[model samples]
Target: MTTVSILPISDANGERIYRAIAPDKQSTGRTAGEALDALTAQLEGDEFNALLLI
Candidate 1:
């Protein structure tokens, strides 16, 4: 199974943000959902379908 980690973080400006980390891809967004969405878009094939969120 493919594993991904989603966590909240602060940007350089101290703005709340969300980050998604996968084996081959990473993405950040203003919200957790957005971060996951962005990461999902970057993934190829059915990888997203078997994603295991951590």
Candidate 2:
């Protein structure tokens, strides 16, 4: 299993932040969903897999 921790935010529900530890031993600690959403608008990408989301 992987480990993930969403960065603390002023309003969690308002913004979605997630951390994903990939199988390659690389980890991302903080990422904004809204930011990704915006990126998704310009580019194409796949879904993210996270061990724990909170």
Candidate 3:
């Protein structure tokens, strides 16, 4: 199942998707956007993939 991990965004319906989090990790942020940015930068490769669910 595609569980959409909710997170903030400058444009939620834009390029970036959810703030990918580890299955056994805790996040440190005040807002979703902040968390998203953190995840975006901390993740493995670039932030471009099949993130949409149709």
Candidate 4:
């Protein structure tokens, strides 16, 4: 099983940002939900593996 963590970070303009982190995978977005959606799509190919999104 692989787990991805969504970290809340700050952007250059001091706005809220979200980043997803996993093995060989990374994604950034304006919101946490958006980041999660992007990460999910990226991991779609691993159909048999378990993924934990945090």
Query: Model 1: C-alpha RMSD to truth?
Result: 1.5
Better of 1 and 4 by lDDT: 1
- How many clashing pairs per prediction, in order? 0, 0, 1, 0
Q: How close is candidate 2 to the true structure, as a TM-score?
A: 0.25
Model 3 over residues 1-54: C-alpha lDDT tens digits? 122254533444455444435443323344565654565455456432314221
lDDT of 2 by residue, 6-42 (tens): 3444435565444333333322224555433343343
Candidate 3 whole-model C-alpha lDDT, 0 to 1: 0.43
**Tens digits of per-residue lDDT for model 1, 1-54:** 568888889999999999999988999999888998899899888787655564
Compute the lDDT of residue 51 as modeled in candidate 1. Answer: 57
**lDDT of every model, 2 decimals:** 0.86, 0.40, 0.43, 0.78
TM-score of 1: 0.85
What TM-score does each of the candidates earn? Answer: 0.85, 0.25, 0.39, 0.74
Number of the top candidate by TM-score? 1
Worst 10 residues of 3 by lDDT: 45-54
Tens-digit lDDT string for candidate 4 (1-54): 667788999999999899987787878999887887787788866641645555
Candidate 3 regions exceeding 4 Å error are 1-4, 7-26, 47-54
For this target, which candidate reaches the highest lDDT against the unseen true structure?
1
